[model samples]
Target: MRIAYRVETVRAAEQELIARLPDGALMQRAAAGLAAATAGMLGRVYGARVVVLAGSGDNGGDALYAGARLARRGAGVSAVLLAPDRAHPDGLAAFLRAGGRVADDPYDVLAAADLVLDGITGIGGHGGLRPDAVPVARAARGSNALVVAVDLPSGIEADSGEVLGEALHADATVTFGAYKPGLLVDPAHAYTGAVRLVDIGLEPHLPSVPDCEALQHADVAQLLPVPTGESDKYRRGVVGIVAGSARYPGAAVLAVAGALHGGAGAVRYVGPAADDVIARFPETLVSAGPPAKAGRVQAWVVGPGLGDAPGVEEVLAADVPVLVDADGLRGLDPAVVRDRAAPTLLTPHAGEAAALLGVSRAEVESARLRSVRELADRYGATVLLKGSTTLVADPGGRAPVRVNPTGTSWLATAGSGDVLSGLAGSLLAAGLTARDAGSVAAYLHGLSARHAANGAPLTASSVASSLTNAWRDVYA
Candidate 1:
């Protein structure tokens, strides 16, 4: 697992190493790694034009020191000092001694450079680029040079992955110590093109668990439950779905359609659209009463196209793990969710999440990590914020946030979310914890959507059908 420590933690670790080792040793290691990375990019360091966008912190120090290494190798290295007065004295001295030049004009340097190293900000920065640094950032973006961020791209919140202000888009980001959360998540992630972790021997000092984690194929496959020879239908786990209404039969069918592919032993669907659900999926056990009366289910998925229906209250009253999505999230009773005996999961897109918080959709989108955590804390449940980067946060605060990386814009089709609700609910029924269930289902759902689309338009049914292949791919 790739663990990402908080900035403070990383700072502490750096200090500890510095205290033990010789002074400036760690920075030199970081600088050397960066020089090697940049050299590889230029093919040959000699005669290569390299520009380092230097800031006031150790990030700039790293860039300058790396520039010195390149200069020693006969490269034409220039530093665009964002804060020349506050720059690291040792780094500046080393660069000057190695025959590096300081660029008076950032645009001129960017125009002629083969590669640009963004050292303007590291994990310490909170907001976007400072006003003085903005022009250089823009110039790098528009230039022909291949931009590489030294630690993290400036103007991005390293912890939350939110782009605070104007950010430089990097062709590749060479991060030190460990993978920061921002590089793996969205908004900021979009600017961080390709991320490479330059191990500076800091992992042992970091936490065992990360602030958030993105699943790999093996991790997802391991988390997926498999049936035993003696397992019966009920033993495998039963998923109870309460969805649809007279006005939205398709919602019920789509939800059940996803549930059918779940490794669950059986699916018991209860709601007003029982007849329609049965018509589409004859394999489902359809019932006409409340979810509690539907009898023995490991998990319950409520509210797809529930349409202000009367039965939602009944389903919400169930003791089993419940997943609320779509219309079910509309004017949801926080008390009902908070008081539930079993774990509850809420899957809401930005619009629905905005409604829950009484905030604008743009606000929710801007700070998605904070929004998901806030929602999970407020409702005392798990929240899966569905969007460009789906984030799953647990209320208990025991685990790191799970960011869904295998998502595609094609998954934006109608009824796609209903399928996710069912898939996650089934995972809950199969005995995974709320956090695991939500994250696992998201991974599978995203993979299924990609498989179904395959660069073409797809419907809800196709996504459901693609689950088998998705599952096989995970196992394979």
Candidate 2:
């Protein structure tokens, strides 16, 4: 698993690491890594034109020192000092000795540079760029140079991943010490193109638990359910899906498609679209009554296209784990969901989440991490915030939130969420916690969409059909 720490935790760890090393040792280690990464991006750095956007702090010191190294290698390196008087004295002297010159005009140097190092801000930076440095940042962005941000893209909240105002968009970001939460999430994640972590010996100083984590293939593979020789259809677990209606029978079919491949022994579907579901997936156990009368089930997935379905209350009243999505989320009583003893997982897009929280959609989108955590706290349920980045948050807010890294824009198609609900519910039935079910479902759902689309437009059914391939790929 890839983990990310908050800015405060990273700073504490950096302090511990710096104290153990000799004077200027940590800075030299960081600058060497930065210089090497910049050199690799330039391929032949011997005669490349490099420009460093240096600010007032240690972040600026890092850029200046890296620029000095590049200058010594025969590269024409220029430093655009945003805070000239307060620049790092030792770093500036080294840069001058290595044949690096101060830029007469930021825009002119940026326009002709082959590579730009964005050291304008660090993890301590709060809001957007300073007024005096705005034009230089803009010029670097507008230029043809391969923009590389040091540590993080300037103007982003390093801890929250919130881009308050104008932020630098880098083609690549070379972060030092450890990965920050901002680099792993959006809208800051969107500004950070490709991220590469440069370890500066801060691992032993960091806490065991991180603020957020992204699971890899091995982690998901271990979490997936595997049937033993003693396991039977009933022993493996049954997932009951309460979805669809007379008007939208396709929702039931898509949900069943996802559930059939979700490692569950049997899928019991209860809805008005029994005929449509049976026609598509003949293996499904169909029932038209409420979920209480649908026989025994380990978990329940409620409300996909359930328009005015009378079973929502009955399912919510059931003792089994429940996953609520789509139309079922409308007018959902937080008190009722929080009172449940069994695990509950809620999957909502930005609009649904906004409506549930009584906030604007833009608010949820801008601060996704905050929105997910808030929803989890209010509902007392695991919330899977679905959008460009899928986040799974625990209700108690003790564990780190999970950020899904595998996703394609093609998942925005119709009926995609219905499939996800079924898959997650199946996992819950297979004995994973609400947090694991939601996060693993998101990971598989995104990967399946990418496999199905292959850079083309794909329907929700295609994504569902590719789940088996996605599962196999994860294992492989």
Per-residue C-alpha lDDT of model 1 across residues 1-476, encoded as one tens digit per residue: 55566788788788877888888999999999999988888898889999989999899999999999999999999999999899989999999999999988888989999999999987899779999889889999999999999899999989888997888899999999988788877888899887888888887777787788888899998899899999988878899998998988899998998888978789999888888888888889988876767878988898999888766677777777889999889889889889888899999999999999999999999888889989998899999999999999998667799888786788888999999888888898989988989888899999998998899888888999899999999998
Poorest stretch of ten by lDDT in candidate 1: 1-10
**What TM-score would you give candidate 1 relative to the actual structure?**
0.95
**Candidate 1: regions farther than 4 A off:** none
Model 2 C-alpha RMSD vs. true structure (Å) is 1.0
Q: Compared with the true structure, what per-residue lDDT tens digits does model 2 show for residues 379-472?
A: 9999999999999999777899999999899899999999999999999999999999999999999999999999999999999999999999
In angstroms, give how far residue 334 of model 2 lies from its true place. 1.0
Clashes of 2: 0
Please report, in order, the local distance difference test score of every candidate based on alpha carbons.
Answer: 0.88, 0.93
Report residue 9 deviation for candidate 2 (angstroms): 0.6
User: What RMSD does each model have against the real structure?
Assistant: 1.8, 1.0
